[model samples]
Target: MQIEPMATATEPTRKIVQRDPARTRARILKAAIAEFSAKGYSGARTVQIATRAKSNIRMLYHYFGGKDALYVRVLEEVLLRLRAAELQLDFESMEPTDGILKMFDFIDTHFGARPELRRLLAFENMNQARHLNRSAVIRDAASPVLGHIANLLRRGEQAGVFRPGIDALHLYTAMVSLAYYSRAHAPTLSRIFGTDLLCHQWQADHHAQSHQMLLGFLSRPTTA
Candidate 1:
């Protein structure tokens, strides 16, 4: 008995457990986003995503089903991040002109901060939005943004600050396109122009120019 007691170890055996399903799912989604953004859907690998998440391919499949499904979820996650942030802004309560500028600023800042989103959009466009089209979540989330812009335009019109017949879709598209192009094509544009568009000074100038262009458009009287 004394000899047996002398051989005993003090440490207890450790057991691995899936303690946090939500956290694991979020990590997988985040890893998927990074992988898809960098490699595009066609080039991205589930094994890479799993490794990035510090998880296994089996776990990734368990959480997201597979690569195509994971890519769609990544798209949904990135888009929803912007949509969720928009809901936090009280654009309706602000003066229309102020709201418009604020919205532009938010978008400019967001695009600057989330270059991955631009890459994702570019990749999706190349795919002709095959995955994006599959997502009703993305479709549903997009509507409210157009509605918000429409509301802002209506308020601005009532206040005589914005021109009539300014379509929300057109306005929204213009704003996003300008912001997207500047950063997305920064390397090429900068090389072509011989100036660094990615630099803070240039970006600031672009932001100001964009503000002026949009506000000027809104201020112009429409031709009958």
Candidate 2:
């Protein structure tokens, strides 16, 4: 599931007049995300990442230790972005269904905007998640969000708007799978179906279907 680099033409070389360590490091991390997403851990090159960042290989190593370290950072950053966004939603204060739908829409919009994340995840999974498993930061990122979802579900059940006995992890997994599977498999599915799954219309239709499916499932009443 490796993606072709979004841009392969190297930027024109420019002389360094001033240095901003924070900005420079951020630039390198951004470049690393693109490189790893495009080529995966094994295929990605340090030189390509350096060139994309307009920095040198030495700085990349300096900031991130090495290719493996940089790849781990990329994994952390992408997952952190999603988790942070989820945390920012005052879903606790909002009505249960509204909060859940808002969460769904956020995930949908985030994936649509950053297909690189889908690519990066696919790349890591292909690697047996050897790199991702090493990062404690990444491992612990989901707890709060899962707890938040559980609380949201509790509220919904109390209000009789959502079914009881839902597992937060299960719900979260369902939400992600519904949102992710289509985009991740778009190309292969497109070829099989003889249609452009990446097209705006196709994505929009799938989004609507996913939203309906999840909402309907959650809103169903629990049987006695």
- Compare the candidates by TM-score and give the number of the best one: 1
Residues 41-70 of candidate 1 have per-residue lDDT tens digits of 989989988898888989888988998888
Clashes of each: 0, 0
Error of 2 at 41 (Å): 0.5
Runs with alpha carbons beyond 4 Å of true place in candidate 1: 1-12, 16-18, 220-224
lDDT of 2: 0.90
Which parts of model 2 have CA positions greater than 4 angstroms off?
A: 1-16, 222-224
The local distance difference test score of each candidate is 0.89, 0.90
Instruction: Tell me model 1's lDDT, rounded to 2 decimals.
Output: 0.89
